[model samples]
Target: MSKWAYSTDGFDRIVHRIDGVETVTYAIGQGEPLVYFHGGGTFHGFEWVRPLAGEFRVFCPYHPNFGESGDAELGGMGDYVAHYEMLFPALGLDTFHLCGASMGGHMAARYAAANPLDVEKLALVSPAGLKSDRASIPDFSKVAPQDIPAMFVADPAWVAPFWPADPSPEWAALRARESAAAFASREDLSLTDRALREGLKGFDRPTLLLWGENDRIVPLGYVPEWEAVLPHAELEIIPGGSHLLLDEFPAAVEALRSFLKG
Candidate 1:
């Protein structure tokens, strides 16, 4: 299996029931707890984050209607926030570090804002929840499917390991399902909720805002939106990077490690 497939053999599998649906969580290592919210198929999966497992107990969860998690017909992203608010305590997480990327980042931001005191630190990587000026001509959704992968990373070769030489229908379906859920999680991509803004004002925890310099999906323009909401967050733009920051830049993971462990 390609490392990008990220085998779960060495990890501990934990299941927690929420809203009558069982959610799966894969955990590794033991130290300061660090929960990572994955963007799943949207950002693509890889083993790059495993290195952090050595120093932090990393929890990777599959959001409802995505991956191994059982399906749940939720209202919207706000419902997701409610699901996790219960899921966190059910997992016995009292206080912990949180990291989120892409769709997951958007979820993490809302989660931390609501429960800021439970999080000791927060990290957002290329989160989706804002509307920025169209970065690509005609926009990324209009691009051909085969060409879409190239837009995620500066070097297309980095994604070579992710594609199976002979992909099964099941594999393709899982990817499509995850992508759909990424969108369904948010009814609208705009983060202009007055309640959310007020919540963020009270979230005084340490925060990190990171983005790939060449991120075509979210674009650097959205960075300022996050900055306005989280003026205290530390911002870092990685060079030679794309939307798939972890895949294109080793520095992305290192920067995250430094921020979380600090």
Candidate 2:
């Protein structure tokens, strides 16, 4: 088991070894645990659900090879499931709320489907599991850098904040590396194809599905698809959010908070 050095960000960060993968977890608050699983590409999990931290004890674990989480070349999604299965019990959590966004949301749904007794509630935000009308997912690596910001947010203004003010060689190199790693391994990591056909049928839980009205990635049309399977689930759309609803829509945090509270 490898140890990851979490920056001294004053957050309750801990490292756990499970299924030979060392996961970096950032935990906050002190009530019932609410696991906040972020998207596949990002570095920080705290940023994904910072606003919800006050309402629930949040446990955000960085998946292997992303962010500060070490890489162990996981075979598939089941590796993640095995790790979390051991993790929750090890942390003395027999039951908790599981919330995830994008790829994380897909993982959360799978986790709930596999361990319904352990998850009290589930929230999937702009989730990516269901196979779309298209046979294959668009390759992110093939998309030009200029297209990334547009694909991610409704407003182009949001793009400025993500890019560097001074494009130094080191910064550019690092960004390139991160982007390559993210896009390259997606075929091996994505749950889109199999998740919907096989995984959707068994997803019966108190599920909340959140969508961005302007989400270009998943497209709002997929809402009905989710509703068909998760008939008991409640759905909400945050306006002006593209694929990155949590960051693009300031209102998403409040909307989710209210939904969870209800």
Candidate 3:
């Protein structure tokens, strides 16, 4: 039996194929669909948008090879777009909101561009397409597990509590295995970092760029470039929040609501 846990949001776990790969998605809520793409690694999609389910009908799908989804024939931004293109129409979503975090932001932007006429709004949270000026992408395999928090957040103190106070031997072993799978997919990260540079300049749809002011992973300087790309787009930089601002700062969630609702 699949150990994947379902949600109380009344979402049903459904599977559909795209290019011979089986993808899993949680379909629930009501009204216009909000298709949320997950960040890099093994995170399930609904966990990414659980907080916003009450506001919009959320469609959170796992990318092939992530979570319960199977591997794709190929892995790349184009492959992801093709998969979503099929998945979207299958759900009967003619027009809907789109939001993504980290690598998912890259995929979301690519998908929106491919289907410009279909997306109602776009939201990117600490997106990953733009390369950092000074910080190179860290290799998880090389870094000490203890150093992981610093790479992803500004304050390690805030996140340490989330880990088990005294993790059992079994718990630690499982976590290591989970981390390995996440690192295995590192190559799938979108390489078209410069594609959104000029293309987003003329994007007329309502767009929001939410950044963590203290984000050390992606840096805070990219805000200017993002503003340049979508001059009319709104930006909300959460003070003291790190790369995982949406999870780190509850107020940031309210900001997202205001931006998307408006």
Best by lDDT: 1
- Looking at model 2, residue 124 earns an lDDT score of 88
Candidate 1 or 2, higher TM-score?
Answer: 1
User: Each prediction's Cα lDDT score?
Assistant: 0.78, 0.69, 0.69
Per-residue alpha-carbon lDDT of model 2 for 1-262, expressed as tens digits? Answer: 2121113254687888766677788887766678877775553225546666677888877777666666666545566666688878766678888888887877787788778888878888988766545323356679986776677678777555454345456445546655554454354333544655466576666788888887877777767767776888988888777778876676887777776677
Worst 10 residues of 2 by lDDT: 1-10
**Candidate number with the higher lDDT (1 or 2):** 1
Q: Please give the lDDT score at residue 71 for candidate 3.
A: 61
Instruction: Go through the candidates in order and give the clash count of each.
Output: 0, 0, 0
TM-score of each model, paired residue for residue: 0.90, 0.83, 0.81
**lDDT tens readout by residue for model 3, 84-107:** 888888878899999887778777
lDDT of 3 at 104: 81
